[model samples]
Target: MNEGIGTTGMAGNDHYRMTVDLNVLDHLGINLYSNIAAVLTEAVANAWDADAENVEIGIDPDGKFIEIKDDGIGMSIEDMNTKYLRVGYRRRDEDQETGRTTAKGRPVMGRKGLGKLSLFSIANTIEVHSAKNGESHGLRMTIDGIHKSVQDKEPFYSPEKLPREEIQVTNGTAILLKDIKRQRLGRGATALRKRLARRFSVVGEAHGFKILIDGHPISTADRGDLPMVQFLWSFGDEEPDLSSAGQLLEREALSDRLDAWDGDWSVTGWIGTARLPKQLDSDDAGNLNSIVVFARGRLFHENILDKLNDGRLYTKYLTGQIEADFLDADDEPDIATSDRQRVQEDDPRYVQLIAFLRKQLTQVEKRWTEWRRLHEVEKAKETSPALAEWLESLPEGFRKSAETLIAKLSALPVDQDEDRKLMYRHGILAFERMKLRGSAEELAAHVHDIDKLLAILADRDSLEASLYRDIVKSRLDAIKDFQGIADDNAKESVLQKYLFDHLWLLDPAWERATASEVMETRLTTDGVLTQDMTEKERLGRVDIAYRTMAGKHIIVELKRVKRKMKLLELQEQGQTYVDKLKKILLAQGDATPNIEVVFVLGEPIDEEGSNPERLKSSMAAISPGSRIVHYDSLIRGAQEAYSEFLKKSKQLDKLERIVDRI
Candidate 1:
């Protein structure tokens, strides 16, 4: 049976007639060209296969007509009828394997003969005029004519011939499509030119190929319009280096392992990240975050960068292309999808190609992390005066260690504000950690700093450390404010507020403290420590309570900043509070409640006061940890500590203001 035979009624000549279903042509035509660019690309490919040195595409401003003209070997009427009109014709079968190249020795870019139908995708009527050997032939193909042929049980359309006057060129073909269905946007020509540049890499005089859209030729120079490539990696044998354009470029080969695929399969290309995300115009073609894949010099896919699944923040700022010609090899199955928009994910070559890309992408991610970290350190030095001073304060050896810690913190991919704040906090921690490095017990107690730094590197967080860190920062601001207060009551109020919000400020060890009570708040209306304290406990209380990790009890008392006290009176009050605390702890079944009391006063006690000598002896007789700190000395020490903290945490300009509010 003939290939075109159909199960139709027999003709009058007693032969079964062949027929085609009209719906097939309609479906293909309607679905083929989703946009005007797709149809134009197919026409250009056909021209490439025809050995055309130049293909001119012209579109009417309003999109009423489109014409694709090529200077190549023109098809005669016989060739058009036998080959061009045959749907799905195999071009490879027409000639020997060597015939895969045109007369000009260009590898044929067309395979299935369906490219001719692409003209129908955009317009209903297509006029084809051609000349070969001084003889000209022409035909007009209309969608209505094809439908009529199908209804008439005809297997193919019989195109009507046109007069010779319409054949303008010699030895070439021109296809004019009229009655366009879609209106062209004013920017369509420019957009199409850019897309065409990205879609085909073999264009330019080097290959004797040129595609002109609306008289504007798309040349290799158009590649310059791509994003600013800070660093480029060339991953194949002698692949073209990106136009330097005065940017630093890193060229290298694909790792031998990833390139070790069988059957001469290899992926070759360069991937580059923009210095900034918005450096590239993001439109229909691609954004900064795009990696186009080309097979046989034609785009098989775009935006494959997003498919790598490597969670590098810098990936969103990348743009490049990879050419895997093996996917389009002669013996390989067509892995490209029907729309030419992407490749079949399950194709073995595609799977291997993605695997290779993943490996390379991971390397790219690591390199970006290092680059950004170094950049952040540079930024910190430029923006933070405090950090500069802190760095100077370090000894040569410790300075190097501090620099390493800063780099680690800067590399964290946190938000802009948090990232800088973390750098600052870690800076202080780094200094402290180094200072206590020799004291094993002290270092362990303050290991939160070291732990937080490591947690950030691991993309985790130590919530307790962060909480106490914030408390310290805010309390530092409060202490600064308290230093400004000269009024006795006002200083007391500020001190109380500061201590209430952050008891850990006096000592980070207090971060584990269970409760805090102002001594006066425990006094009842009857002037006794009541069994159950009421809201009146707020009347006065300067005590903050702490139970160490080892279960030893501690109490801290605050005195008015400007108040002077008698040594005996202070001792009597302290002994009374201690007695009450002991009764409470002992009643809870503790055979011994190891207790320590600290008195934080605003001024030094009268040095020549009565019993001053006795007071000093009694204080030494009591717990050695018990001590008195004048408010002035305490505020000065706190200020100096925070100043050191500020210097160490150099990039904390934003966090400084935020903490001041607290």
Candidate 2:
């Protein structure tokens, strides 16, 4: 059952089961340590384990060193050599199994061992000093930049921390890193500080610690600066996650909620924020793209972000602390490593802990959504000016066209651009706006503005609107109103009203109110359904012919029918006409013009309440000459409306015909 689950590029001698990869380490140093907060996290983790009450960090951009000092129980010379020097040493489990619990019997915090390597990712050289067990000492470590200076060579050696530079330390640990790498500061460094503060909320307790960067102290609480935080579940006293092989044997006591072996230390520190400021740039993170992971006073993964299978929708908002104290060696059944270092996810204990993390995250997000609604309003001022302006200018065609569009836009309010996956690449939203991506409707409203601008250039607004009625607006409005009506009879009533009063608003071609000419459409042989489409309705009308010899032909086809089913039988009637016409025209050798089809229902059938399966099942055949109308609305009484006294006659005549036909 025990199988290898990590990196497979084992390059050292064959016998060395835990051989280190110099290439990976070198890559990790350059690629992973890309953030200021991550580097600070490593330093703070050390402080937490040392029983440090406070930790302070100072960043000096011009100077070479970034110093972090903590008031923790310092290290002795022997602990440094045996423990600190050994890479991949799994000793936390033994410590926890025996001496894992704190004075309060709380499980430990440090696990998953690889924190310090990330420091090398940021700085080439580091210096350390610790005063613990009533003794004080200082030690220095150099990354040997000269060797790493080569073009792609992975050296076999590790970071060098020698005794030559050692001095007896007092009651704390102070470390300094030289040649620092910053992810993104100066631009949004303050944001990163807040991020760090939000992620490590567990620190600064017991012997509370303080973390500083560039001489600025990170805020201990970000619930104020953050958008919304919803509590899903909090960690309570529990056993640690452990593994013999790989098959997880969960415990029996907890509720069916989710089983987590590790006891809760501090799962606090998550911060969910509203849509960010518009000026989001890659340069914002500087070099760090992800948060760092720690295990047993050591480093595990740096720049480890939400990847495939991570499956958390709001994972970008996931900034917090994960406690792994139970994995210590002193705990029963052992939760950690041989070195009391880090938690292994393969270890059944860690998996159970992750399940708990996933569950808790779901809760946080659920509550966060409610919180998002309330606080998201305050940040409206932070909306991108370009975005805000674009949305404001949406319906700018001829005075008629633009206003019509605006009216429609107002109905479906959108304030965010949720899906920005291809926005930048497609040049829809520039990279700047994309970086600060929000809800989709908000972005669509901006795109709608661009369409208006294009309309203005086309002089479509030449048509004046005495009553603010643009044909496009009228048409769009008609669709909305049509979609709103529940009954077909009410729809007939609305259409009759269109004949007189709103007649002028319609296109000149459709303005004439007459039941005299019936438009006949035909779709025939060349109808080929797309192979990729599996559903039957995917086999749709290949052609539609709107025959109007006197006025313009406005071809309308029922492409969408959410209320009824697609009447494929209607297409049969259309096909017969098309075949007869083609033969007649072919025999006479007469030239025929092409007519574009406007799906009565639209091409993208709306999403809110569409059941493609049901729609597909409803496409039965129909007879020739029978009209298949997608939308039909009538104005109450166009020019004849003033004659309300003759309501009975009017109803008997045009109204009866319309009602019976419908």
Candidate 3:
């Protein structure tokens, strides 16, 4: 016996009849297909090799059975024994020597002669029925029989023959597999039909070939599942002798030649990019990123995407097919891996293909990067005018980087437009900060004029401005209501509540003040203030104090908005509160406190009022740190600042109206 062959029997003349080891069938069957699609693709490829005009696949509703029938040159019993059943046959070697072509003048798609074993990947039982000439035959094979043959030490076993009455097809072959082993998820008739469509590029009436799942034909015209293609590049136009009907039309090509690589060998067919990534939804199959590799008009490798992984953003948008028939040329070494899922990645031919793809990928990446930038800019315009302005403000270097980032973000796993907006907004603020940092003089001035300078510090065009403006306007409204207070006691309490949140209404300088806590009990204990008087006669006196960033203690005394004030009386009352605060600090042995007192009275003395000049002198003569402010004065400054901002604002009017309604 030969090393790779086995003797099944002896002829009468003493010649040994050869057969493959039964273990070869088991090995090929289990390792051949990763899924039902691969198995069905093998059957379809065999039909194409036989010059089939129509191949139909039927899936049983219960999912336990499938039928693959083809209208082709069916095999007689002798042809089946010698050719169809031969394992590991070198069909390409025979075809090259004989110059064999199918009846339709189509190149055969089968190589390695292992496609028949793919049937066992899905089912335990296979029933094959074929007819040649006027005679018909039927046979059944099972996994158990193959196992029994190996156990019995039988080198090979032949399928049982069926009488003419058992034959179902008259001029072709029908293969039925029942009791399927591993059904693919969502493997129904419709899904199978779509997979078939993606797996083959030459299934059409124009090529005199048709494929149907159930009754639905997988037609090239049915492009509903395909991504929206933008450009096509064909590689086979250089030599007419090597061209086939399956090659893309010259009119459809973006370029007649693939300029990335100039060599004796080049791949022919078409590769294209979608307008957008097809994997933009979780339900998407991620087919658009694949470059399906075909040989002899059938998918030999599903994708070469992994080989050209240059970390480019454009790869997500790419999807197409390239038939590198030179890979299977007689002179080339057999580089296809045993499972047929991929070829040897290290093969010189494949390395060349990958190198060429890397260069081509860069071209598409640049194009896609530009497309995405324009697309996102337009979307920002529709979503937010401010965002559009911010995007345009980006410097050229940074803008190009942002465009590349946008092109790389996956649209799937979740919605991406909202994510894009978030990233864009953050980028805008960061760039604005960087630009502002470059101006040392402006940054120095911002410390003293923070309220007026916020437009430069903050990203004013950002949508967050709407929220900040609403807050400021609401505080203004609360302060306006304070002007109508008549009772001193009621007015004092109302002012405390309003001023706590509306510190900006008093003076923008107080925006960073700590929340106020009442110190009435402490003041009373220090003997600097009295708490026994009536709430009315007491004038609702409350001492609210806070420490500044420089550690200076400040006391704020509130008077009713309607109360008339004498400058001398206001000064006297503030002096008592400041004295008490100083005593408490000294008693605790704290660092000598630098404290200031502020009197927020209802009104300032009028010029027409008695001794107005004397009142002004009285206030000026008080402790240097003590100052008097009218309620009207505090509100006026706040109102003026807000009015100036609103006058300059274009997009914040909505915030103004919302505050008015509040």
The most accurate candidate by lDDT is 1
lDDT of 1 by residue, 1-662 (tens): 56545533444556576665665766555457666777777778877877788999887887788888998787888878877777766676676753467777776666666767877877889998877777788899998898889888875678888887776667788899998877423247777777778778678777789999888898754654343776666676745634443554343445523636885777777777665565655474445468888776777786677677765456756778778887777666777765576778888888888888888878876675456445655666676666656667767856655554555444444558656665566546534543544322232223335564444434424433434555457767777666665344454445655664555556656665555344234433224333332432453344343334467666666667667766766666567656676666566687677767677776677753555666666555444456676656657767776666455444545434532322
Task: Tell me the RMSD of model 3 versus the true structure.
Answer: 18.2
Residue lDDT tens for model 2, 421-450: 122122222211222332223333243356
Which ranges of candidate 2 are over 4 A from the true structure? 1-32, 61-63, 94-107, 133-136, 145-169, 182-189, 205-207, 213-217, 223-471, 474-662
In candidate 1, stretches whose alpha carbon ends up further than 4 angstroms from where it belongs are 1-20, 97-99, 151-153, 183-186, 221-226, 244-249, 256-259, 374-662
For model 1, the local distance difference test gives 0.65
Show the lowest summed lDDT stretch of 10 residues, model 2. Answer: 243-252
> If ranked by lDDT, best first, what sequence of candidates would result?
1, 3, 2
- Candidate 3 at residue 334, lDDT? 76
Which portions of model 3 show Cα errors greater than 4 Å?
A: 1-20, 95-100, 182-186, 221-225, 228-264, 274-287, 391-420, 435-662
Of 1 and 2, the candidate ranking higher by lDDT: 1
Give the alpha-carbon lDDT of every model: 0.65, 0.42, 0.63
- Candidate 3 to truth, TM: 0.58
Lowest-sum lDDT 10-residue window in model 3: 240-249
